[model samples]
Target: MNGIEAPNRLAELRQAAALTQQEVAERVGVPVSAGQVSRWERGEQAPSLRYRHRLAAVFGVGVADLGIPSAPLPRQRSSAEDWFVSDEQDPRVTKSQDEWRRTRALLNQNRHSLSQVAADLYPEHRLAGTGLIAGGGWIPEQPVDLARIELSEVPDAPEPVLSGGEREAARMLPDQTLTRSYDRYTRAVRDLAPPRLFEDRVSWRLLDVDWSAGAGRMSFGDTTYFNAVDVFEPCAHELAYVALDADGGLAAHPHMRDLPYRKLIGSPFDFARRPVMPAISTLTIRRGAGDDVSFLLHRRDPRAVAAAGGMLQVIPSGIFQPSSLMPAGRAADFDLWRNIQREFSEELLGMPECDGHGRPVDYTSGPFAVLDQARADGRLTVHCLGVALDALTLVGEILTVLVVDAPVFDSLAADFVERNDEGTVVAERFPFTEGGVRGLLDSGSVAPAGAGCLELAWRWRDVLL
Candidate 1:
């Protein structure tokens, strides 16, 4: 194991310390960003023990706490498929146990040499695990004797993956995941000691736009009864990312608190430049049925338990699907939105809505939308910051104008305009179906913004009411 990522433990540290990226950087005397913190939590990056010591110092914790030894070594490696958590047996995490022993021995012996290596690798950098420059567990103050030390890079397992394990685990995996398994973990998360010091910031920007033609409005007649309002502003270019657990509650992982307060909860941010998404990504695993999540392991190694520590799987069923009806050109429409946003404005709308997870259609571009040439006067502009499960990263947010009823649309075809000048939206009566989303009753009037988005509620509940 050359690189077993410990997202869970890393997240625990950040959460326990309650330090923001800038705070962590300053405490450790290094320059770091929230993005760097995210990479650490995502298993995309790693900090040497020296840096880890610095992190420990900043958090007022011991270096050993930062190390949650549960990984394979050089002689042994487990792919995502090889690991599994079985009810019939305890996970064979002995490999992690052995590695920790080796690491401890090496650290005690060659602390100075390793610190020198780390300092060379990161000049002006302090230890992360110890959060110290030189002292007990510190490099210079208590250098590990180079003569007796058998130093080497800590061996780690390959990143766990669903690999082909998803297939085999399916055989033994349960259909519905019980929340009980996550309970003790949740308690551990809640008990993390708070950080001693932290500096934080929140940044936001507006996404300017140009209104255009052929743009229409959507309204809910029941919106009047329920007091639907323009809950969010559309000026921000950032989005918030929220993870959900198997039991349908928010993921609310502890490490997120370390993000800049503005982006603390994946809230939102404003940006001037356009955000680009991956051109193409192949889904290693497709959607599964309820509780079918049992088979969802990386190499059947049970190490996923550790990975899931700070991260979320973004299981297909866990996503929030706003709209049930599937249209053929939704993918095409999203492509157009991306094209227009990238080519014209940085807005991410002008297309159908998307569930936070995988697209109903194969990946085309992204979960972007816009507020450009697609708006009119009566349109209510709402700004929002959100995050995508598959793509990762917060959107800071984008502006979306909900034109209750465009005058042009009414003029072009009164029947098509759901919300008209009369504060009423004509319904496309599905005389045959009892409860169908056909038309609005009187949804043109704006209500006050509530704690949660009334607009989102109106859009979804309109179908039933």
Candidate 2:
């Protein structure tokens, strides 16, 4: 077993035991401390022979069922001390040449034993018999193969079959809640790995939103290529999920789409190996928040986004998100905002009476504007975001409101919520501590526009015959 997989297996076995660390410690005859069992299960350390024997007896399995050497009490301490250490990172301790040859012979024997066990226990090994319980461990009696029995079969698998211990395991598995948080909280990280060797660039289209020009699926390299098409004006903070799959020759949509870690982590095969072929993720950031800005998103498919120094930054026109200094009004100077309907109308007819707001009540309403005022005990606190949107601009779209408090502005600007056209929300941060929301541009400021972030809407120009 790889050293890493040990923790995962111990957790599974512990759960099957229907015992808590406190209960398991008691049953295993370990010291009084409950945490010792927990630390052992976590792969932080190992326990003693007394504990191992106790665990095997209680679980009704061999000590090797846990996928590690039995922790026997030292016999002839001087001699065995040179063989192996319970907790040393280095396997090579001082060993005389004679002991080395003996150790190698024992290891070769163990390897053959493991090979036979693997052949018996694994269907892929094509061994004879029921092919189960091949793990070589010191046991007073025959050991059990827990995986060979499915939970659904427990009720009907013969009368006196459970051996008391298996029944205890079944009971414990249902109620056990032992846990370990895999969060690596170290904020400072150094590159022992090359930057390019990291996850390569990838793209993803919103699956449910539109699967046709669907984002390109994972190919040979690690990439989730995407095809971004413009959609209707999006909501302020409505959330959505992002899912991906390793594109296979099969043309069917999988029932288990959210492949990564989630409540429905699917079957044991999902986490036990390869953690499912694909993964699912989510973001709280909304559709139209400016950080996901892609001019191509407003036109063609957007380039895959990349990360550097632990932060994901948007790249526009094949350029990393520009630090073009904070805007005078905190927005790009270019008027990326447009009125396409007017252009369409110009191509089709002479002129239209409707105003930019698509209203007839008119710009004739003479200097129209809305102001916000907040008050305290006979005093006024000056609060302003310094920009405004023309009041008549909103007609067919939703407005994320954060109107400036100015006494004389005509437009209504909003607290922008952002998303790609497919509606997969772009988030500013994930729970990950090291490589989260930083490096993305400063989304810390406020803005004024019906959509304060980025304004995205489908645009098409057709020539009349």
Window of ten residues with lowest summed lDDT in model 2: 230-239
lDDT of 2 by residue, 1-465 (tens): 565556425567778855577866554432335776676677566554334434544454444566655443333433222333442222222112112222222222222222223222234322122111111110112111111211111112222111112221121111111132111101000000011111212211111111112111111111121100000000000001111112211122222232122112122221121111111110111112223212111111111111111112121111111112233311221111111112112211223312212222221122111111212221111111111111111001111111112221112112222432112223232221112222111231111121111221110001000
Error of 1 at 453 (Å): 6.7
Which digits, one per residue and each the tens of the lDDT, describe model 1 over residues 1-465?
Answer: 249656546677766655566656554543445565565566555554334444554554554666633331222212221233321212232222223223322222232232223223222433222111211211121111112222121123222121112232122111122321212211111112112221111111112221213122111110110010001100010111212232323344323232222122222222212221111100011112332111110111111111111111111111111111244433233332222222111111123323222334433333222123223232312222111111122221111112212332233233222221111221321121112211111121111111011222224222212
TM-score for every candidate vs. truth?
A: 0.18, 0.16
Which is the leading candidate under TM-score? 1
lDDT scores in order: 0.25, 0.22
- Quality of model 1 by C-alpha lDDT: 0.25
In terms of lDDT, model 2 sits at 0.22
